[model samples]
Target: MSETNDSLAEEKELLKSVENAPASKKISTYAKLSGPGWLQGAITLGGGSLGGSLYLGIIGGTELLWLQPLMMIFGILMLSVIGYVTLSTGKKPFQAINEHINPVLGWGWLIAAMLANLVWAMPQFSL
Candidate 1:
């Protein structure tokens, strides 16, 4: 009975300490919350990227290695902007883009993304 009481007290104290922990000190909290977005970004590097790299290598050879890095930098910048907008406003990207920017532009982006995915997936499926 005494051992059980002691364990319960220790558990309560641990819970209290966790509840009082500072936000900045909780790196795992941010990591857990942001993990899905990171996973999605990683998974997006699929057939399209492979195809692009193959074409770039064949056509431009080593000379165009700089272009791939440049494109990746731009892609990172774009994802950062989308993440900021989504997180800050607590809104989905397409809705936020349509509301704050232009609806036509938003729709255009969606259509273009869909087309690109289809184009990329087709070659992979054919293989």
Candidate 2:
């Protein structure tokens, strides 16, 4: 019993140390740590994923389990490309695009993305 309790305590301390160690290293190197949180929230809150989950729960049950895996694959592919572009240039995605390509093209893409998001927002609010 004492051995079990000691092992659990050691595991808890190891977990905390692992978590805090990365954060301390980032701070020491002046690296930004908040980007991952925003990236995670963006992926998790995407309309397609949420809609699929809701629709599956309402209509199809677990029969549509395959879609979730497909969505995750595509989402990771996109994020990987975005992260590569951002990291290679040390610029946010928007700035990198506008800097490498024409500002007009960059802004055009931004406007199109905004319009798509606006279309998505309408159904979200109605629901």
Candidate 3:
């Protein structure tokens, strides 16, 4: 749709403008411009909601319906715990994970996030 493309273009521009300032600024800019995308990605990307939903929704209608929401709740809880740990300790997530958890896990998380963003976002540019 024209509207979708227009919005995506605007958001791409906005994100580009804030790309290098700082992590906080980039997050604030995204929250300002595309709150829904941020929320959707935060919650659903925990288990590949978009693609999985499209495929799963096709075959699994009412059977085992409680599982998806259950997973989402657990995902949210996990993210909250991670946030609490990072904030209470006053260390960046990457730094905390590297120090407290495994450094390789921290790097893997970072790369996966970057790749996920790139995977979905690159299509908007072609539009």
Candidate 4:
């Protein structure tokens, strides 16, 4: 336990040193940029997905049978757009949009995403 605590304290000190280091001393660009893509995929695969499925099942009573395919199509379209943005500008979609697109469009996407997240939050919050 003492050794573990000492190791953690050492790590904390290392992190503090890194934080205080000059920008020129820092290594820029690592594997972590892939994190958002994995995180987005995980959200799609996990709670958002299960909840969307259950909500459709309960609310639409099988009439939403077509919605699964529709959602897939929509997802593909959105991802394609993201791909285009990335390929064209060598930047992530959010950054590409904010940098290249109209300011209004950038803000609009932010608002739309927030609203979508809010809607998704409703069922989880209620339960």
List TM-score per model, in order. 0.61, 0.44, 0.44, 0.53
| Model 3: residues with Cα > 4 Å off, grouped in runs | 1-54, 115-127
Clashing pairs in 4: none
Q: Which regions of candidate 1 deviate over 4 angstroms? A: 1-31, 121-127
lDDT of 1 by residue, 1-127 (tens): 5996796697667556666578764555546545488767655676667887899799999999898789779878877877787766668999988888789977987897789677654565543
Write the candidate numbers in order of decreasing lDDT. 1, 3, 4, 2
Worst 10 residues of 4 by lDDT: 26-35
| Superposition error at 61 for model 2 (Å) | 4.3
Worst 10 residues of 2 by lDDT: 26-35
Task: Give me the candidate number with maximum TM-score.
Answer: 1
Cα deviation at 102, candidate 2, in Å, is 12
Model 4 per-residue lDDT tens digits across residues 12-85: 77556667676654433222324487766756565666777888899998998899889779978877876898
Tens-digit per-residue lDDT, 1-127, candidate 2: 5996796697667555556567776464333424366665664566665775787767877787787688669857766765687777878788987887578866876896688567544455544
Candidate with the larger TM-score of 1 and 4: 1
Compared with the true structure, all predictions reach lDDT values of 0.74, 0.66, 0.72, 0.71
**Candidate 3 structure quality by residue, lDDT tens digits, 27-47:** 788679754657767544544
